[model samples]
Target chain A: MEFDLEFALETVGPLLMAFLQVTLVVTVAGSVVAALLGLIWAVCQRELPTPVRLPLSWVLDVIRMTPLPLQLLFAVAIFISFDGYRKFPDTDVETIGMILGVAVFAIHYSTYMAESYRAGIDSIRQGQWEAATALSLPRSRVWRAVIIPQALRATLPSLGNWAIAMFKDTPFLLVILVPEMVAKAKQLGGASYQYTEVFTVAGLIFLAASYPTAVLMRKLEKKLVY
Target chain B: MSDFFQAISDYSPYLWEGARVTLALSGGGAVVALVVAVVLGLCAISPVAVLRVGSRVIVEFFRGTSLVVQLFFLFYVFPLFGIDLPGMWCGIVGLGLNYGAYGSEVVRGSLNAVAKVQWESTTALSMSWPLAVRRVIWPQAWGLMLPGLNNLMVMLVKGTAVALLIGLHDLTYWVEVMRKDPEVGLWIAYGAGFLFYYLIALACSSGLRLLERRAQRRLGLAPSKTRTTRATAEAVA
Candidate 1:
């Protein structure tokens, strides 16, 4: 367990490649999924009738309440089981299964994202809605032109916060064998028995990436405040 | 459905053991987190620059890194330095430190939210800083911080699933094991886990909500029945 500087330096290249290729890609894609799906959930919650909205809300609550690793495991298990039933090649199954796992990640986080969007929408003044109504604007136009823009602006910082949260959570993708940064670090550590050096570097990389993003988000949050 | 029930019955003892571990980790971590939150939070707002900066750095570093890495570091690396912790202890410490960093923000925010007038009043009364904080500031700030802390607590419970990675036989670990058994099957294994976790989460949130309600009531933010009745009578009069 001596911290080998050389090994740590060597470890960084592969870890960063895994990070940029798998970890960063999953995060960016997951964030996009969260944003779009979360917005849709928010809008649906607001506009749908009680019968539909209540059940939908409950479902989202279950998603939000559960630990993400469980969701990923569950989704992967299902996909893997489905792969068993299908007449598919073995190699392609893992890649597709991991994609589905990332989708599950997006869906899980989207519940949280939906709450932020809901808060943004709730913060909109009644006057804006009334103004749209007084103008006799169509429902879709009012949503498109008036409501969504304001809510999106208000929610940008919180959305960014969720994205950071999602970024941190990308490590859990290792549960489903996604070969993300932490998984790469673990593999390197296992190979070299330099868990200290490798994991410390991995932790440092996480800190380096997330800390600045967090600071930037705080600044953006402050700037966005009227 | 019967097959699912059969799976649950077969695995109940094992699952229960895992649930106990999960609960233990969560409860222990929460205690650790509370202590860390208060200490770091106070230091963050302390008059001494070194204390403030030191605590801020610790908070940011813990908050920045992924908890899994931290857990792995503790479990795998710390032993190298002759600082061996049990697997469960590693999980608890990891959960505690990570969540504690987040909880410190809630603590700092709620403590800062206490009115400046209250601070000045303590000075007016010639109260010592600790006495003022213990008797005056904390009572008010406690109520405000509970809601945020409750949210974190629920999160901490969910986070205990990470304990499985550290070789702790937590609930998630049991479910994962069960999933590999064809008798239990994937659906039953995960379905049962989902229910168990959801129930635990629901219980934690509702229990915390009750505490929050009582705290709010003590602060007079929640309208007590007597107070509401009295106010209605006065309005009628």
Candidate 2:
């Protein structure tokens, strides 16, 4: 019924611990997976023949268009079904499974990231491609020496934005019982009926963590502008 | 599989109901978002310093926090403060405020994107501020902002899936419920859910693109043949 400072303060420690242990872990790992896989998707879409590219783009579109929570549920279901209903084993296997589930976040965001990468690649003028051709560079050499470095530079800020987005979405991991910050706050709140305090603190933590990075991305975007 | 098809046929009614709820949430949230976006967006670009600063703080606050926390706050915490919003209202408010903050940026950007000459021309005509905005600035900015808003609409449709957490019987919730049945199977339940969501998103985007083309045509600009998707992606990124 009222704001309880003591209980709110108490919830912060466990929530922060969960943020570091689960939320931060999933976000960092997911960002890595998304960046790598997204670049691969971008490159393949760009260079591969239409036969290979068309289906790949369609698959990525499906992944992008669906809700992340649905993807998370689908992923956890597949994990459970494949493992013969050995749900959340109390071992390293649980950790491994959680990582695998985090891949859903990666794959989902990778579609967006791939779009940014494609935009970056497209921004490269025809003159650059012609220069590479004019130099008689090998096909692989042109991509490696001339193309990727430039695209990566242009896309860096947008990629950081996606990482921040993935950070916020880490809470969706709750659907699969991943014990992230919000889920921990909910569990802690259930004991005292102080959902207000716990959720407030959790939301503030998210704002505190993400806002600075977003501002930095804005600055970087300005710097990168030609 | 026959079992998958049977499960779908057996639950088609429920699935359709869920789809309807999802659509309603998306539509409601979008209305709220559009209202919030236009108001806050206009205030964001207002000449008054206080209005600009106030809207900036509000937008950043909503944008900075995760939507899940916001939904939980409205559903759970606000009631503690005697606000007592319904679960569906919580979902709508949460989605609207969060995406509205993002959409406000789109609105602000497109408004700014209108040429400075347009603003000067309004002044040259001795037009009142509201009239100038309504007549001159808005028409040009509308077409420009539509693509960005279109992207946000697709994102909003996907975002409606989170309403399931608030106990809304949206499509995601139904798919989740069906997934609990061992016979229905995760593959079929989730696969069908994915297909439905994809279709909804595809429909929203294509619909918006048509609207965008019409707006551009009304502005007497030729519909751009390319770079629309790129522009939308860049705006969000």
Candidate 3:
């Protein structure tokens, strides 16, 4: 029951490292989905004439309005059900479920990011859009040439904050047995009956992973006028 | 079909019991977090270099980490250090600390949203720092932080979903338990849980907003930052 710092670190450190890799994998995959679907959602919001916008909006709403655990559970159940019926059976179902969960995570978050983009886009001053229209610059060209980069740069600090959040949030995957940091912490804790050093080290690793970027963000925010 | 309604008809009491526990956990955790967030939020904006840096470090450290890990750390990990907390209290403290970091930022931002001129006026009035803060600054910050504080409470409710992981029988955990009953079906269980959560969240948010507006009426203040953060993060985002 006593805290043994050295022995605990020796035991749980490597395991936490492995789980941190799982966290990294989930973060990357989820970031990709967020970026891709984020852009799609952005485009849909801009080009509202498309018939698909309503359903897409509803899907995003469902994704956003629900909690991540419910989403994760739903994702796991759906993947299990769907995989049970079709696709190669028992072939990396956890991996599939994790990806789906991450995608759900991405979509859930990207709605927030989409608002950031919308804010950044709004910051362009309506005159710029008017000028683009006046110059006969196609709407697509205007967004590509004049908007996206600036919107992205303006959105970087906020987006980085969310990236760190998504990393922190990877722990919820333990419910599905994805073996991320918290999951690994629990495994190591139970295996050794020493949860103290294991989860403390895990928390420190999470802090290490995220704090520098936040410091850098504050610095970046000060550098930018807007 | 009949069994589904009967199960809910009978099991409604257990579900309500669980929801009450969830409410107590969320409600108590929120009060502790509110005081902590305000103090830390002010410390975050402290003129003293040491205070500001220390506060920032603690804030980022908590916010950057996972809530469930923090909860597990308290429950399972603390006992390894010879400190035992009951499961529900452990859950509450973990959630309070984690969401308190988020709340601190909200509080800090809303406080700063007050004008530099207001500070100048307090200085012009030749008031002591505490006097200035209590009389002039805090009222303005209250209007600003109210909506944000409400939203943070809602986010805390959402974050409480993680308690399901550590096997604390919150609303989500109970719904998860209900999912075991084949009579009601899994999706129905989950759907009912979602509906329960959405109703609670919607009511909490709308109630907070109503209170916020009432407070605004009493204070005669309207600030942009508080309104936007409340609208975006708490209710919608």
Candidate 4:
């Protein structure tokens, strides 16, 4: 059969969109988890006792150094055997896969987020800490009031950029059979030898999504410069 | 643990062979990436309007898309157009283009970060444009570019894992092969895989650190007293 662009688009487009919803959900959920966990790690590493800090930092380094796909595979091997991995007997396996996929992505990205947060924290004026101390703010109060707010503000662009990265990386979940967009495209390709058309459409979908988000991120970065 | 040792002893030869491919792919891809980075990076900063716009478009297109798709395209689609490449070449070219896009930015940023006075003084000395870039600008920029390039080299090592997805018998592929053996437990197999990758990354990082120090010294950005530093110091004046 000829390479029918119309047939490929008509047949594969909606399937890919359905998968895009899964991708978006994972990206949002994973970004939130990563941002929170990374911030916590950054703060803990700096302030916690040496007994807790050193090993935590070493683990973060390992996480940062490893390729993400291997970590996803490792997560699957580890989590699939758990009794509670499915969460509910009635839950679909794909849903469980999505949850595990998000967990792995969050864990992997949290290390990078920690580095970004650490940089933002380090960039804060030393006098800000001294002034907070002079004002008799407790350590927790100092972090909540003076530190995290500024750090998060400084790091918003990076967080947004990482969210976009998470968006691209959702395809990795396909390795565990999570049926993200690329997986759907592959399924579509198998039905007809139009892998080219299907993957092109899939790539365009990613570009269409990523480019606008990147532009918006650039705008946010400019606006947030204070 | 007993099984782990048995599998390692049995598969050590295969794993070493795989490790060799992994290093070769990363090393070869890094060379291609560095060439692409410097060329496109220079084009990006060139005075010609078309060159800048053309390089920017090329870089953005590569950077914007997922590398997996790029590899897939190179693997699957190229044969359709009658330009068939070997499996490993697909991985190398895909990585070269993707990370080259990234490295170009590092090159451009560092080149731009060189002190503006350096450029102006070089121009005032009646050096030609290319001469100014080579003699005055690049020496300083090279030092700044080293750390970013070093980071990219480590990233390249990790990225070599994707070659396995495209059916290249790289380290990750061998790891999967060994891991799939019912005799070898998953934990041990994955642990060994992680060890191999981590060690490669660690070596790449330290090697690049030595190169960075040399670059810094040549640019006199380091504190070490040396003849090169003295010459660079005089040249800076």
The better-scoring model by TM-score among 3 and 4 is: 4
Predicted structure with the largest TM-score when compared to the true one: 2
For residue B69, model 4's alpha carbon misses the true position, in angstroms, by 0.9
Q: Lowest summed-lDDT stretch of 10 residues in model 4 chain B?
A: B228-237
lDDT by candidate, in order shown: 0.82, 0.85, 0.72, 0.78
Please name the candidate that would achieve the greatest DockQ relative to the true structure.
2
RMSD (CA, Å), each prediction: 6.4, 2.1, 3.5, 5.5
Model 2 chain B: lowest-lDDT 10 consecutive positions: B228-237
Q: Mark the 10 consecutive residues where model 3 chain A has the least summed lDDT.
A: A57-66
Q: Candidate 3 regions off by >4 Å?
A: A49-62, A83-86, B1-10, B47-54, B215-237
TM-score of each model's chain B = 0.90, 0.92, 0.88, 0.90
Cα lDDT tens digits for candidate 2, A5-124: 999998889999999988888888888999999999999998999999999999999998889988888877777778834544565654754686579888988998898888889889
Model 2, B1-237: lDDT tens per residue? 787789889889999999998998898899999998899988988889999999999888887888899999998888878899988888888899988888888888888889999999999999987898889998899999898898788888999988867778889888988989877878788878998999999998899899999999898999964433433433333
**Candidate 1 Cα misplacement greater than 4 A, ranges:** A84-94, B223-237
lDDT of 4 by residue, A124-179 (tens): 99999999999999999999999989987877777777777667667777667788
Q: Write the per-residue lDDT of candidate 1 for residues B1-237, one digit (tens) a residue.
A: 999899999999999999999899989999999999999988887778999999989998898898888899899899888999999899889999988888888788778889999999999999988889889998898877776777678778888988867777889889999999988889889989988888888898788777778888888896222111111111111
Going through the candidates in order, what fraction of the true interface contacts does each contain? 0.58, 0.65, 0.44, 0.29
- TM-scores for all candidates? 0.93, 0.95, 0.88, 0.91
Residue-level lDDT of model 3, residues A119-200, one tens digit each, is 5665667787788789999878988987787677766665656666677788888777786767766777787787777877
lDDT string, candidate 4, B86-193, tens digits: 988998898888788878877887788899998889878999879998988888888777777776777778788787667777777777677678778678888898
Model 4 spans with C-alpha error above 4 angstroms: A1-3, A83-89, B1-4, B222-237
**Candidate 2 C-alpha error for residue A225, in Å:** 2.3
